[model samples]
Target: MIVATVQGNEKGGKHITVKDGVKIFGKEQQEYINNIYDKFHINRIEIIGDFGIKKIKSKEWFCYMKHPEVDASGRTGIAFIVWDKNTEDDTIEKTIREIGFRDEDYIKFNKEYNKIKKGKSNKKKQLIFLVGLGMGLAAGLIVITLSMIKK
Candidate 1:
């Protein structure tokens, strides 16, 4: 579980640190965060606020980003606050509203997460099926051997 904040402009942001509330490792942190940003299409959208939920490195994260209000002549900068999805569900729900979310976004995120879950489930299903088949075969061989001995 982790939480953090970062500031960015058109170029990009900086290293996320404990000061922001999370201690993510080197390049891996940047990669996963970028993935989350991509999944939500953050860069393409032009608005004051937005938020989303997605998995990063097998863990779910809640990200809320917004551009601070500025005068017409001033440049707008982006700020992001992120946290582990497992904790404070009610709190995060209330917080993201300051940004925005739609039922479709939830559906999309869940669809992606379930795909990952389903992939892992397929492996388990195969293992269970193999085990069951092996047991059935073993029982059949035992029954044949016993009947032969009776003869």
Candidate 2:
């Protein structure tokens, strides 16, 4: 199996890289990845497949890590996608650290992503409500002005 490490982004962006001739959700691969995530308490696992030249597809059975710290931060997390190989007898967390990712950093990344998503949702709702309110007030003012002119 190939071993690779991904770096976390500051803006809570999800980064995905596709490799050819690799299956991510075979029985053994899923079990192995699940075990590692369980041991280290990862926040989310997204499996994507390349759809010929820049398109990709999300696979079923994606695992979401329920880390409250990550859930609150709105920061992005780091994920390493291994293909065509199995993990050897080594601690997965240690390997991740060696790739310049601290355990705490991963948690923080997850938190940031969650926070950003929440903030975006909230902003959309607020903007729509404000726009509607503004339109209503404007219409009401126009009606009152017309009545005063008639009087």
**Index of the highest-TM-score prediction:** 1
lDDT of 1 by residue, 71-102 (tens): 34465433344455465644443333323334
Query: What's the lDDT for all of these models?
Result: 0.50, 0.42
* Segments in model 2 whose C-alpha atoms lie over 4 Å from true places: 1-103
Question: Best lDDT goes to which candidate?
Answer: 1
Instruction: List the candidates' TM-scores in order.
Output: 0.38, 0.36
TM-score of 2: 0.36
Residues 1-151, model 2: lDDT tens digits = 3333232343453322222223333465446555445533343334443100111122211122222223235643445433221333233334434445557744553465446547867999999999999999999999999999999
